[model samples]
Target: MIIKVPGSLSIGQVAESTGLSVHALRFYEQEGLFVNAVRRGPGGRRLYTQDDVDWLNVCIILRASGMPLTVLRRYAELVREGAGNAQERLALMREHQERVTAEIGRLTESLDLISFKVGVYEDLVDQGDAAVRQCHGPSLPDEARTPDLRHEAMAE
Candidate 1:
């Protein structure tokens, strides 16, 4: 049973505080991401406590960090089960940490490639050769004939 807590917040208030849409809050509740049952006021309106808001903030960060809903739900289940599950929780967090670390490595590599391209463009601009390099054709000078950078992906 959900105890009536002092300083209960309405759904709208929770949404505003958490930067989540009301719909997303409902979806999170539906997805079993809340560790405790959501409380309701008279006439069955959903009410929330500061603890709920705090928990949702954690959920927000976890989701922002790319924790999938299933994994989050499992974590919530473990929490709701209560006591004696430290090992499982630790294992779950360790696995997610590994994935996050790997993702950071991948993103770093991608950033390196983007930085290299930026350097190339900056050099072209500095040399005032941007106009010459913009058009790719056989008539261009040898130095400007580096390679066809006219790929569709580079159009952006």
Candidate 2:
């Protein structure tokens, strides 16, 4: 499925190659996140080129890293505009990079706490009287507890 497909590729081929469902491909199209318009063939079947598949893979990675659909659409728009918007694209990517980095730190801390909690449980399970350790984390930052503060703070 991961061939350097020449000419036009069917939606199924693209999906298989990119590890996305056909529905997701359609959703991305509907969300206007594609740099190139998906061309249609007989019977209005969506056809994708190799470059489109590559772009979809990139989009998949960005989405996996927690990029919001809106932001991704904006990034795709910037890319579609060609060369002049490089600065804007870079700014958006840099912002996302910072957010992703912060998230990694948060996840690492959480995993460490979880690992420690596991050890606490293991010790208690084996010896009936082990000191129960508390893994207290910071109160859900104002952002996690509040749903509407996205506009006021770093939502990511």
Candidate 3:
């Protein structure tokens, strides 16, 4: 039997809206991830509010962005504590922003290398079977491999 609480969502409803499984929702509550305690409906079933949904969305995005559970929990704790910790919250967000920015920079560099590899393959494809066969031969010795002169140019 499902209990209907006016203006409150059931665990199933919250799960559908947040794209989180019921198990995960339970785990989040167990881990104290919610800014405020989740209320209970009849039969002790969990009842969620729209505000809960909004907070869950924030948590989902932060978690997806690689914020560790401990960090996320700390952020939520600060938020739950109300207006006194804005500076601390700002510091935490700034730290996370720096980490995310550095990660994006590293990923961009990796993508550039991947793009270059793809270009090499595309060129081999255009050069026909002989080039493909030659390219597939035993790996070149370190001394025989062409040095990336781009680094030398960058050092200038």
- Most lDDT-accurate candidate: 2
Please give the CA lDDT of all the candidate structures: 0.79, 0.80, 0.78
Residue 92 in candidate 1, Cα distance off native in Å: 0.5
C-alpha lDDT (0 to 100) for residue 53 of candidate 1: 86
Clashing pairs in 3: none
Question: Between prediction 1 and prediction 2, which has the larger lDDT?
Answer: 2
Q: Ten-residue segment with the worst summed lDDT in candidate 3?
A: 133-142
Candidate 1 Cα misplacement greater than 4 A, ranges:
1-6, 130-156
TM-score of 3: 0.78
RMSD for each of the candidates = 8.3, 6.9, 8.1
Candidates sorted on lDDT, descending: 2, 1, 3
Give per-candidate clash totals: 0, 0, 0
Q: For model 2, how does the per-residue alpha-carbon lDDT over 1-156 read when each residue is reduced to its tens digit?
A: 344768899999988888899999999999999999999999999999989988987898899999999999999999999989888999999999999999997677566545655765687778676556444333446545334332322321
Name the lDDT of candidate 2. Answer: 0.80
In candidate 2, how many clashes are counted? 0
TM-scores for the candidates = 0.79, 0.77, 0.78
